[model samples]
Target: MNNPDSLTNHFLIAMPNLADENFARSVTLICEHSEEGCMGIVINRLTDLHLCDIFDQLGITPDKASHANDVVYLGGPVQSNRGFVLHEPLGKWESTLSVTDRFGVSTSRDILEAIAENRGPEKFIVALGYAGWGVGQLEREITENSWLSGPANQDIIFNLPLEQRWKAAAQLVGVDLTTLSSEAGHA
Candidate 1:
C-alpha cells in the first residue's frame, strides 16, 4: 500500500494485556501488508521442531551440519504444516514474498535446498505458518493497545536471542514494556 503507515517490514510487539496464547509476549515481523491483510512471522517463539526436522521431512540431505541451526520458529497459528523461510538480501526464489530489498519470505523448496548446502543467503529463519490479520484487524488491535509497532530491526530478528526480542523490539520505539500494565483501560 502507498499508505505511509502500512506496517510492512515492521515489528508488532504484543502489549502486556493481550492474552491470546498465540500472540502473548510475541514479537511478530510484519513482512507484507496491504488492503487485503497483513502477513508476518512470530520471530521469537520457538517450537520443539528444528531445521533438521524440516530437512528430514522434506527428504533433504547433508542436514547433519545443521546441528548448530535449531532455528525453526513457530511463526504463527495459520498454515502450521507449511514452512516459510525468512531471509535477508532478498535473493531469487521460486515463491518468495519480497518484504524489502533487504528481506524476503520464501516458501519454496529451492531456497531450502540452497540453504541445506550452504549456498543460501547469509542469514535465514525457517518458520512454521505465519501470523495474519485481515483488513483493519491489526489497526483495531493497535487502537485497543494490544500491540506496539515500529520499524523492523534485523539484529533483533536474526542475531538477538529469542527471549530478548519482545522487549528489544518495543525498545526500538522507546516503550519500556516492563512498566506497562497488563490491563487495558476503558473510559
Candidate 2:
C-alpha cells in the first residue's frame, strides 16, 4: 500500500514502456487520492488555446497592465470542457486544493479573476480537463511497471518552458525519452 502522505504531491512519471496514449511519457501529479481512486493533471501537454481566450469566453477581462497571457495546458481526458489551474503557491482561493507545499489546484472563477488581475499565484499552468482513475486502476498500472513515481519539482511543473517539461521530467529518473522503447517486453 502506498503511504497516503507520500503519494501526495508526487509525480507519476510514465515508464519507457507505457503504451497508453493518455499516459505515454506523461507526468501526472497525484492531487486527490482516497478510496475513490486517484485524480491528477498531466503537467506537460500544451493546448492550442490561450488563457485569454478562455477568459474572453467567460466575459472576464484580464488586467491590461499585467502581462496577461495565461498558459493553457491539456489537463487530462475527463471533463475536457472544464478548466483546472495548477499553480505556484500564493494568494489562496476558497477552492484551492494543495497538491504539495509548492503547488496547488484551483477550479474556481475567483481564482481565475485573481490570476487575470496579477494577484494570483506567482507561477501557474492552466489546464483543460483532468485525468482520473477508477479504484485500483492506477495501482494496477503501477504494478505493471507503467509508471515510475517521483517527487514533484516546481521548476519542471511551473517554471520550465512547456516544450522542455516532458524531457526534463523524464530526466528526473535518468531516462531520456527519445531513447525510450514503447514496446513492452516479456523476456
Model 1 misplacement above 4 A: 67-69, 183-187
What is the C-alpha lDDT profile of model 1 across 57-126, one tens digit per residue?
9998844564336668899999998899899879999998988888899999999898888788888899
Give me the candidate number with maximum TM-score. Answer: 1
Say which candidate scores most in lDDT.
1
- Put down candidate 2 lDDT per residue, 1-187, tens digits, no spaces: 5565446677888786777887777788888777778899999777888878888888888898653575688889999899998887745687888776667899999988887888877888889999998888888888787887776788888777766776787688787778866666796
- lDDT (Cα, 0-100) at 145 in candidate 1: 91
Q: What is the lDDT of candidate 1?
A: 0.89
| lDDT: worst 10-residue window of model 1 | 62-71
For model 2, what is the error of residue 151's alpha carbon versus the real structure, in angstroms, after optimal superposition?
Answer: 0.8
| TM-score (all chains, Cα) for each model | 0.94, 0.87
